[model samples]
Target: MKKLRFSAFLAALMLTTLTACSTTDSGRRTVGQYVDDAAITAGVKAAIVNEPTLKVSEIQVETYEGVVQLSGFVSSAANIATASTVARSVNGVKSVKNDIRLK
Candidate 1:
């Protein structure tokens, strides 16, 4: 019975160690999944600010992992396309989902 208990304890210790050692890609203190989402959000916001045809006030940016979800009203289809293109150009952006409604 003592031997079985020791084995189980060792197994649990190994699992804990492995879990603690795992980390995200950035490797900056492993801020967890929220950090990745925040990075994408910041990237999208920066892209929108730099895009000539897309006004920052007219769009909302939400990010999950590296995928960006853009939703809002824009002046024209060209503006929407421009926004999506701009968002895609941002670093660390895995995908762009443009859900902007044309006004």
Candidate 2:
């Protein structure tokens, strides 16, 4: 019985810690939002990799609140346009900010 009580207390403490960490005074993201952004970033990267005209290694992807920001150097103007289109096609992307430049 004592061991069970200690275990319950530990669980409650951990839960409180996680909840507290999720709240911020600055405009920072919560834990769940961070996870969502990571998923969006991954989806954008995967989409870029699948595009035959775009080189996956040449692009960098980041996401915040469903907005994806893509930046890097590509071979041509068409590749830049293609990357933007591909990022926009992803499921969780609200909008895309394409900063890709021609190499």
Candidate of highest TM-score: 2
Candidate 2 regions exceeding 4 Å error are 2-21, 24-27
Best by lDDT: 2
lDDT by residue (1-103, candidate 2, tens digit) is 9999999999999998888568442658787778888999999999988999998999999998999999999989999999999999999899999899989
Cα lDDT tens digits, model 1, 1-103, are 9999999999999998876766666664444566778987887898788877779999999977788999999989999889888888888888989999988
Q: What are the lDDT figures for the candidates, one per model?
A: 0.85, 0.90
Candidate 2 RMSD to the correct structure: 2.8
Clash total of candidate 2: 0
Task: Give the distance in Å from residue 90's predicted Cα in candidate 1 to where it truly belongs.
Answer: 1.0
Over the full model, what C-alpha lDDT does candidate 2 score relative to the true structure?
0.90
Minimum summed lDDT over a 10-residue window in model 2 is located at 20-29
Clashes of each: 0, 0
